[model samples]
Target: MTISSPSSPQEYIKHHLHSLQFGEGFWAFNLDSLFFSILLGVIFLSIFHRVAHKATTGVPGKLQCAVEMIIEFVDKTVKDMFSGQNKLIAPLALTIFVWVFLMNLMDLLPIDFLPYISQQLGLPYLRVVPTADVSITMSMAIGVFLLIIIYTFKYKGVKGFIKDYTLHPFNHWAFAPINLLLETVSLLSKPISLGLRLFGNMYAGELIFILIAALIPWWSQWVLSLPWAIFHILIITLQAFIFMVLTIVYLSMASETEDH
Candidate 1:
C-alpha cells in the first residue's frame, strides 16, 4: 500500500478532521474518537490506580506525588463546590477532569505523529482527540445530565422535580405553563451548552494545529506551532477544569431543596 501525502492545504485539513468512521447516517460511528477516548481513559485510570494502590506512608515516588496532587486538587474542588453529601461526586469529578485533559493533550503532539504512524500500520486515518468530536462531547455531557436528573429525583422526589419545572421561578399558579417551558429549556440547555463549548474549543484548536502544519513552510513550521502548543496547554487544562466545575455546579443545583 502506498502512503499518500496530503495534496493541498484544503485536503490536509479535510483529512485531519475526518474521523475513521463506519456505517452510515445516524447509525454511523466515529471509530477513531471511541478508540482514542477509551484508550486514554484506560491509560490514565491505570496509572492513577497503580500509583494509589501501591501508595505508602513513607516518602512517595515522583509519579505518586504528582498523582496525589491531582487527586487532592480535584477532591478539594468537589468539597468546596458540592453542598450535599454523596460519595460519588469527587471520584466522578476526578475522572472527568483527568480524562478530558488527557484527550486534549493529544492536540499537543506533532500534527502528523499519530496519523503518520497509523497510516504506516495500514490504518486509513486517525484523529486522536475525542473531545473535538461533537458527538463524543454530547455523549459525555448527556451522561452528566443523566446524573443530575438522578440526583434531582433522589433528593427532591418526583413531585418536587415536577414542581421545579412548574413553579418557584415565577411562583404563581397562572404561570406554571410558562415556567415549565422556561425551566425545561434551561435544564436541557445545560447539556447542550456543556457539549458544544468543549467541542467548539477543541475542534478550533485541532483545526488551527492542522492549519499551521498544512499552510506553513516545512522548514519553519515549529515557529508558530511551538507557541500555539504552549498556549494550548492552558486551554487543555482550563477546558477540563471548566467541564468538571460545571458538572459539579449542575449536580449541586440538582441536590438543592427549593425551600433553601
Candidate 2:
C-alpha cells in the first residue's frame, strides 16, 4: 500500500487530530485515548510484575536494576513530599510517572509509521500518544483534582478543609472572603494547569514531528528526523517527570493539615 498526503496542511493536521470518539461534542469520549492509556498501564504493570517476580538479591538483572532505581526515586520523592502516612500514594505516584512517560515516549516513533500501518489495515487514523490529546490530559487532571478533594476531606475533614481555606495565608474577617475566593480559584486551577502543561508539551512535540515529516525529500527525511527524535526524548521525559512531580505535590498539599 502506498501512503499519500492529504490535500492540504489543514487536512493533514485534522486527520492527525481526530480521535476515536464515542459521543458528540462536549459529551464526546475519546475511545482512542482510553484504549492507549489502559494498554500502556497494563504493559507497565506487566513489566513491573515480571521484574518483581524475578527479583534476586544475589545479582540484579538489568530490568530489575532499572525498576529498582525508579522505585527508589519515587520512594524518595514520596518520603520528602508526603508525611501524612498514606500506603497507596507511593505506588500510585510511580504508576503515574511510568505510565505517563510511556505515553509521552510514543511520540518518538516514526511519524508516518503507525498511520501507514493503520491505513494499510484499512484504518485511516491512529494517534499513539494519549497524553498528547487535551481531553485525555484534562480527564487525568480532573481525576487528580477529585482525588485531592477526596483526600482533603478524608484526611482533614470537611470542616477542616473549609477552615483551612478560609483561614489560610491571611486570617481576618475582612480577608476571609478574598482568601476563600483566592483559595477556591487556586484549587480549581490545579487540574487546568496540570492538564495544559502535559497537553501543550506533547501536542507541540507532535506538531513539530508532523512539520518535520512534511519537509521530507524521502532520502533526507531519515537523517533529519533522527536528530529531532533524539532531542524529543528529553522533552517527553521532562514532561512526564514534571507531570508526576506536580501530581505528587498537589496530592501531598491536599493531604496536609492546617499547619502545613
Quote the positional error of residue 27 for candidate 1 in Å: 1.2
> Candidate 2 local accuracy as lDDT?
0.85
Summarize candidate 1's per-residue lDDT along 1-260 as a digit string, tens digits. Answer: 24567799998988898888888999989999999999999999899989989999899999999998999999999999999899999999999999999999988888798888999898777898999999999999999999989999999999999888888588788999999999989999999999999999999999998998899999898899889999999999999999999999999999998563
For all candidates, the clash counts are: 0, 0
Off by more than 4 A, model 1: 1-4
Candidate 2: RMSD to truth: 2.5
Task: Give the Cα lDDT of each candidate.
Answer: 0.92, 0.85
Model 1 earns a TM-score of 0.97
- In model 1, the clashing pairs are none
RMSD of each: 1.4, 2.5
